[model samples]
Target: MSIEYGEAQLLPGEKIAITTDTATEPFWKKAKERKLTACRCASCGHFRMPPTPYCPECQSREMSWPDLPGTATVFSFAICTRSPYSGEPLIYVPVVVDLDGAPGARLVSNLIGIKAEDVEIGMKVTVDWNPIQDDWLLPIFRPV
Candidate 1:
């Protein structure tokens, strides 16, 4: 699958709605507590992001969520001049980061606290919360 995005030039004003369900509620729930978590296969210990209903490695519906270190490496990123959701002119860095403690698990989040030109692969970062609609927090990253 191909995901297309761009390098964001400046930080955008965040005001979007988020919805969750059985497979992803735990993630949002933990974010409310200021914790980072990833889904793990209860039977195999394999970690996955965007929490799936079934494990690809073991096909087990059973899952466990383990708290992460709130640290990650930038696997890929983009600096864009437009908001992905609203299509208005804005600046934000969209990034795919490899979770520090969860092998093979990566999160798609925005990067802040650093300039767009300076962002690079293998950059170390830590999580920061973005308060959005419904009292939920979105996980964004910043240089560590």
Candidate 2:
């Protein structure tokens, strides 16, 4: 259960682990379906990233999964010129994106479809899916 991405091996079954908790299962399930979902507090109407069992704002145990447009802005980024694992020359930029729908939510992902030097903070981006398997997809962002 391993797939090759460039020179790296991606083992979804081995590398990806989902918790059996009720609060977090939906997020991973929707991601596998190529949809972006965020957890919202039912009591205080607050949204949270890295979904948790209880809401931080109101301490509510009720949560709901809502679909997101997957649009985001580059909050910060770093360009990796060398791979730490393989010691190969790499030109990828990993960005921290501020999601549009969730005000305080930020997602860490790789920026693609453009050169690393061209990336800038506040750049508009949209989500794209890279299929790792029939039931697994990785979320990537590209310049819009």
Model 1 residue runs over 4 Å out of place are: 1-14, 85-88
- Give the distance in Å from residue 83's predicted Cα in candidate 2 to where it truly belongs: 2.4
lDDT to native, each model: 0.86, 0.75
- Tell me the lDDT of model 1 at 17: 73
Give stretches of model 2 more than 4 Å off. Answer: 1-21
Q: What is the C-alpha lDDT profile of model 2 across 14-128, one tens digit per residue?
A: 3333343677678768888788877889788898877888899989999877789989999998777665556776566778999888878888877888766677899999987
Span of 10 residues, lowest total lDDT, candidate 1: 4-13
Evaluated with lDDT, which candidate comes out highest?
A: 1
Candidate 2 local Cα displacement, residue 93, angstroms? 1.1
Output the TM-score of candidate 1.
0.88
What TM-score does model 2 achieve against the real structure?
0.80
Q: Report the Cα RMSD per candidate.
A: 4.8, 6.7
User: In model 2, which residue pairs have backbone atoms overlapping below 3 Å?
Assistant: none
The most accurate candidate by TM-score is 1
lDDT for each residue of candidate 1 in 1-144, tens digit (9 for 90 to 100): 633333434333356678898999999999999999999999999998889899999899998988999999999997787667679877678899999889999999989887677789999999998888788888889899
